[model samples]
Target: MRVQLKHPARLALALAFGFITASAAAAQEPTPEPQPAPAPAPEPAPAPEEPAPQDPAPEKCEVVIDAAGVPINAEPVTVKASFSRDIGQPARAQVASESGVRVLSAEPDAETPLTFTLTLDTSAGNAGDWAIALEGEGGACEGTISVLPASAPPSR
Candidate 1:
């Protein structure tokens, strides 16, 4: 068959090819998608566990001591102190004298209630009106000690 290239027909063919090429290009390109909103942040988890109970506070205890009125002249004086359940630990007792005497030793009761034998240094002149003190695990107890002078001979 004999072919004829007319101006209108050529223009029409070109336009058709352009449309096809544009459509093919568009089909090959990827389409943009609408992004989903970010998921709401999860609420913080509840606290791990409950705390344990605490022990009750200790009660005030009564402390007492007794000794002979007779004075014994010695380098290391011996005075006895007694403690009961009313009193706490035996280690807290502190013995002192008004004369600023040194405490050589404090012997705690091994059995039964807590008793202490406070040894003092006579060199410090720690005799007459000495003050004995007791202390608990807490602070010092009220009116701890009283070291009276040795018993004197009756006057004629």
Candidate 2:
């Protein structure tokens, strides 16, 4: 079929058709969806704990030399010492000599004074100064002992 129309009328009709097609397509299309909010930031982890500090060791006991008995012949020498702190019952005593003096016996006098007997080894040349030590639950102590020459006479 053939239809005749003027140039201006053809242009107007074409423009109207294009406008109607664009409006129908826009109405039929679906609307865009909204986006969800971002997740909350995670909390930081806690720090580790440190250990507590320790205390220092206690000080050693004090000992004072009161008197020392004479060393005569082959007999043992006696030493008396006073303790600064009270050592409980069943205290321990020891002797250390520079010239080979040996401890023969030791005893604690109730509380304060501690007595010890040191045997002079004439064969090993134990005729000089010696050191005595005493220890117990309370604390510890140290003292000294002196011996005369073998040729010297006993004078205590």
Candidate 3:
């Protein structure tokens, strides 16, 4: 079973047969299985944003002191103190004197004039005037109250 390619026609046929066999072998050879395209690199996460700045609130203001006067009474009597403007909420009342008179209680109303009905006890206080002050969350006002001797009883 020996074949010779000495003639021109036999040489051409041999070359064509060799080329076809090479092609067939190449086609049958297992090509590297296409690797799944590497999953695209995961995209980077986005950054968080900062909040906008805000303005600060205004400060508490002082109110006007229109009038501060006590009408009457010194023996556990309530007195009213009127203001000209808003004074927030009346927190408390303070009283001072050169004698024994003092304030028993203080109550604030939520209406105009900013009235403070203060109970003043003058039983153990001397007959004189005392300083009365009203303090609130926003402002303060001060005035004076007089304590005097009661009138004597007439003869029966």
How many residue pairs clash in all the candidates, one count each?
Answer: 2, 0, 0
lDDT tens per residue, model 1, 1-156 = 977667888979999999999999999999999999999999999999977768765554444556543143445667666654434543444445455556577666666456656676654354454455666554444334444444576899
* Local lDDT at 74 for model 3: 40
Query: Which segments of candidate 1 are over 4 A away from where they belong?
Result: 1-63, 70-72, 84-97, 136-139, 142-156
**Full ranking by TM-score:** 3, 2, 1
Report the lDDT tens digits of candidate 2 across residue range 8-91: 888898999999999999989998888899999998887787677687666665655554433534655555566566555426
Displacement of the residue 154 alpha carbon in candidate 1, Å: 16
In model 2, what is the error at residue 138, expressed in angstroms?
2.8
Best by lDDT: 3
State the displacement of the C-alpha of residue 63, model 3, in Å, after optimal TM-score superposition.
12
lDDT digits (tens) for residues 1-156 of candidate 3: 897667899889888999999999999999998888788888889888867768655443332223343333444766566655556676776667564666677676546456666677766666656666667787766666665655566879
TM-scores across all candidates? 0.40, 0.44, 0.45
lDDT of each: 0.59, 0.59, 0.63
Residue 28 alpha-carbon offset, candidate 1, angstroms: 99
Off by over 4 Å in 3: 1-75, 110-112
Of 1 and 3, the candidate ranking higher by TM-score: 3
Ranking by lDDT: 3, 2, 1
Q: What lDDT does model 1 reach?
A: 0.59
